[model samples]
Target: MSFEIIGKTEQIELMASGKAIHDLSRLEKQYGQGKWRKLKGVALVRLRNGKIRKAELHWYEAHGIGKKEIKRKRYLD
Candidate 1:
C-alpha cells in the first residue's frame, strides 16, 4: 500500500520541503501485522529547525479493484 497527497504540490503555500522516510520494519517486527488495519497512526517528525510536529496518517482501502481513503487521524502536538 502507498499514499498520495490531495493537491498539486507546487501550488501548496507552505508544505514540508524536506522529508525523511523511516524504515518501519522494526514496527512490524515489534508489533505484528494484525494491528495495521483500521489503525492509522500519527507521524512524529522532527524538523531541521529542531521543532517536533505531528501529521495525520491516511490509508487507502481496497475496493473492487481501486482503493479509497478510508481512515485518517490528527496528530498530537
Candidate 2:
C-alpha cells in the first residue's frame, strides 16, 4: 500500500522548522511493508554539504518486547 502524509506542505514545513523532528516510526507504520526492511540500509544518500552516509541493517528490541517488535536496523557506512 502506498503511504501518504496526512498533512499539507505548510504543516510539513512548519514541523521541519521546529526542533521536534519528524517521526519515522509513524511513517513506517503507515507506509512500510515488504519484510519491514530498513530504507537506509538499501539506499544511498548524499547530504547537501557533500557528506555521504551509509547504513547497515540491524535487529533491535526494547525491554518486554518480542521478536516481532524488532524495529528497522541502522548503521553508519
Candidate 3:
C-alpha cells in the first residue's frame, strides 16, 4: 500500500536484527552493506485514498542506508 507518514513514528520497537533478518542479503544488495534491522512502529499515515489513520508499520533499516521498504502491516485505528 502507498502512504505518506504524517508525523514521527512512535512506540518504536525492534523485531529482528543482524542475522535474524531473512532478507539480509537482499537488503544489502539493494541498499548497501551494513548492520540490518527489522523494526515496527506506530504512526499516523496519509494513505493513497487521502484518509489519515494510525497504523503499524514494518520496515528494514541499516546504519547509512536508512529505512527501506516501509510497509503498512495493519491498521491500528
> Which candidate wins on TM-score?
3
Tens-place lDDT per residue, model 1, 1-77, is 13333432221122111122132344345543322222244555444566555656544322232223333344356
Q: List candidate 1 stretches off by more than 4 Å.
A: 1-37, 44-52, 62-72
| Candidate 2 lDDT, 1-77, residue by residue in tens | 11211222121111121123244365346544222321112323344566544433222222243223222234346
lDDT of 3 by residue, 1-77 (tens): 58999999999999999999999988888888999999999999998889999999999988888998999999988
Return the lDDT, model 2, position 15.
15
Candidates by TM-score, descending order: 3, 1, 2
Q: For model 1, give the RMSD to the true fold.
A: 13.4
Each model's TM-score, in the order given? Answer: 0.24, 0.22, 0.95
lDDT of each: 0.36, 0.30, 0.93
**Model 1 residue 43 distance off true place after TM-score fit, in angstroms:** 1.3
Query: In lDDT terms, how accurate is model 2?
Result: 0.30
Query: Per-candidate RMSD vs. true structure?
Result: 13.4, 15.3, 0.9
Error of 2 at 63 (Å): 34
lDDT of 1 at 65: 25
